[model samples]
Target: MKKKDSNTIAQNRKAIHDYTILETVEAGMVLQGTEIKSIRNGRINLKDGFATIRNGEAYLHNVHISPYEQGNIFNHDPLRARKLLMKKKQIHSLIGETKNAGITLIPLKIYIKNGFAKVLIGVAKGKKQYDKREDLKRKDINREVERALKNR
Candidate 1:
């Protein structure tokens, strides 16, 4: 069998523009049997996804995992909340930090790691409109510089 580095299923590109990621951690997912199969087929969307803690358990919210094509009867709900697996210590810390103003948890990406489904959770703060605009300007500048270098 060949060992794979990762099989990225979905990403939340909006998270990058809306939040300034302070920390990132890989977390395992609690998926139903059919849900995992759908994720393996890259039928997932993280566009509207976020994470929260309830009763000390972390759950991913708003992530859309399309129902498996063959899972006619037992397919999981596409937008149902899914549990995220993480250490007790990590969960506690995130909970504490989120008590402060403007800090929240965002799910950045979903991927398969070593054959297990995992989500990359980012501890992030909401970015101001100006911050996002500045980032875009910088990106354009970098793109133009690369293009000029290519032509030289």
Candidate 2:
């Protein structure tokens, strides 16, 4: 398990295992009523979530922000596709990059920064089975080295 920062609400750990992240960009979310409240309460899930650029804009898909308990009828949908706020230049750059076969946009983590909800979006490519195995092996070796150093 990885230690999270105080403001980190959720992380898509599987993204690291399944994708080779090439670059990361911090983007703001256009949230609806009660969504911010739920996020502040840590009622968010990044698993199975991904981002996309469409019609010259960026949007986040499949992210789950649980409805607030006290929100009643004002609560937003838990799995709605939310718009992402990013500069036009950045969006254009992303469009060009994602045009490559197999390249994708994925949300790695979400956190509160400067009192606003921000997501770290990664430009990534899918990893092969052998790549996953190699990552696991690297992790095991690193852990063993750490343990040996601690015992020295």
- Per-structure clash totals for the candidates: 0, 0
Give me the candidate number with maximum lDDT. Answer: 2
TM-score of 1: 0.91
> Would you list the C-alpha lDDT of every candidate in the order shown?
0.90, 0.95
Worst 10 residues of 1 by lDDT: 1-10
The C-alpha stretches of model 2 lying farther than 4 A from their native spots are none
Checking candidate 1 for backbone clashes, the offending pairs are none
In angstroms, the error of model 2 at 128 is: 0.7
Cα error, residue 51 of model 1, in Å, equals: 0.5
Candidate 2 clashes: the total is 0
Instruction: Give candidate 1's total backbone clashes.
Output: 0
Misplaced by over 4 Å in model 1 are 1-6
User: What C-alpha lDDT does candidate 2 achieve relative to the native structure?
Assistant: 0.95
